[model samples]
Target chain A: DAGVTQSPTHLIKTRGQQVTLRCSPISGHKSVSWYQQVLGQGPQFIFQYYEKEERGRGNFPDRFSARQFPNYSSELNVNALLLGDSALYLCASSSPVYGGETEAFFGQGTRLTVV
Target chain B: EDKVVQSPLSLVVHEGDTVTLNCSYEVTNFRSLLWYKQEKKAPTFLFMLTSSGIEKKSGRLSSILDKKELFSILNITATQTGDSAVYLCAVNNAGNMLTFGGGTRLMVKP
Candidate 1:
């Protein structure tokens, strides 16, 4: 089975601009989460969607939001980007069953650079 | 707030050497701990350690979790150049959330 897949792969945006990153979860998976990994740091959680509902949210600000489509595909949006917003945006998917989420799989991530 | 910390922020070793990476977390309502290897982009899953004292091994890699002490360690034997990457330790807490540590950058010289 194919693993989690994310798109654009690369993104370049200007300060004050808005950007959207997309993710498609693995087949039969029901949960999708977003994370941001700054250079020289580990990934930090953003948001998680399961069954088209918001299940969890991290410490990110109001500028960050996400949604899960009917097919379980997810999209993360960041508004009014800042230079500090430049980082790798990752998408992880897990089946919601017991022990399923314990082993969430990650996508290659979208590299976002804000200038 | 949940926090995960990794020790020896970075390490350098030769191919034949073995290394141990440590992770300690202070998370509320802790559920599970996980390890991942990141080459350049997204991280790849390595192990999920839930039960205490039980060691999970794959190839030259092994990991054990200690729930009481709230720490875990990852061991890689016979390290190879291919093993050079950032090793991240993450914790899965309540609300189905995952929090990560700063990661240990490992560089193995062939």
Candidate 2:
């Protein structure tokens, strides 16, 4: 089976611009999560959606938002991007069964550069 | 606040050498601890440990979790250059969200 897949592997945006990154979860998976990874740092959680509902959210600001579709796909949107917003956005999918013990598979991630 | 911390922020070793990576976490409601290997863009899953004592092993890599001390260790035996990457430790809390550590950058020289 294919792993999690993300779209627009690379993106370049300007400050104050808005950007959207997309993710398609693995087949039969109902949970999709978004994370941002800065250079030389581990990924920071942004949002997690299961069954088309917001299940969990991280410490990100209002500028960051995400939603999941019925197909279990997800989109992460960042508004009024700042230079500090530049980072690699990752998407991971998991089957949260048996009390969230399932392993999550991650995508290659979309590299966003804001100038 | 839930947090995960990794030790020895970075390490350098030659091939065939063995290395042990450490991860300690403090979470409100701990569910599991995971290890991932990141090379360039993506992080590949290595192990998900929830129970203590029983070690999980794959090939030359192995990991064990200790819920009592809230720490885990990843052991890689006979390391190779291909084993070089950023090793990340993340904790799955009760909320089903993953909290990642700063990661340990490993460099294996031939």
Candidate 3:
């Protein structure tokens, strides 16, 4: 089976612009989560969607939002991006039978650079 | 607020030497802890620990969690150059959200 896949391996955008990153989860996986990893730091959770519903969200600002499609694929949207938003946005997918406690498989991630 | 902190932010060790990475977390409704190895692009899952005292092992890498102490340690024995990467520790809380540490950069020189 194919692992999780993310689009636009690298993206460049100007300040105040909007951008959207896409993620295709592994087949049979129902959970998709978004994380932002700044240079020299680990990833920070942004949001999680399971079964086409918003399961969880992090402390990120309202500018950051995400949604899961019926096919279980996910898209993370950022509006009016700031320089601080430049980072590697990773998408992780997992199959949690009990709603949690399961392991996750990550995609290569989308590198966003705000100019 | 949930937080995960890793010690010795970075380490340099010669091949065949051993290294230990530490992670401490303060999460309200702690559930489990996880370790991931990030080479350059993606992070691959290494181990997950929920119950204390039980050690999870994979080849030269092993990890143990101490729920009572709110910390976890990952040990790499006889490290190889292939083991060079950023070791990340994350705390998974009841919300199913993972709070990740800053990560420990391991440089194994041949």
DockQ of each: 0.75, 0.73, 0.72
lDDT of 3 by residue, A1-115 (tens): 8999999999999999999999999999989999999999989999999899998999899999899999999999999999999999999998876646468789999999999
Supply every candidate's count of residue pairs whose N, Cα or C atoms clash at under 3 angstroms.
Answer: 0, 0, 0
Q: Candidate 2 lDDT, tens digit per residue, A83-107?
A: 9999999999888576554788999
- RMSD for all candidates, in order, please: 1.1, 1.0, 1.1
Q: Higher DockQ: candidate 1 or 3?
A: 1
State, as a TM-score between 0 and 1, how close model 2 is to the true structure: 0.98
CAPRI classification of candidate 2? medium
Q: Compose the digit string of candidate 3's lDDT tens values, residues B1-110.
A: 89999998999999999999999999989888999999988899999888999999999999999998899999999999999999999988854578999999999999
For model 1, how does the per-residue alpha-carbon lDDT over A1-115 read when each residue is reduced to its tens digit?
7989999999999999999999999999888999999999999999999899999988989999999999999999999999999999999988766544547899999999999
lDDT score for residue B12 of model 2: 99
Candidate 1, residue A73: lDDT: 99
> What are the chain A TM-scores of the candidates, in order?
0.96, 0.96, 0.96
Ranking by DockQ: 1, 2, 3
Per-residue lDDT tens digits for candidate 1, residues B1-110, read 88999998999999999999999999988888999999989799999888999999999999999999999999999999999999999999854478999999999999
Error of 1 at A27 (Å): 0.6
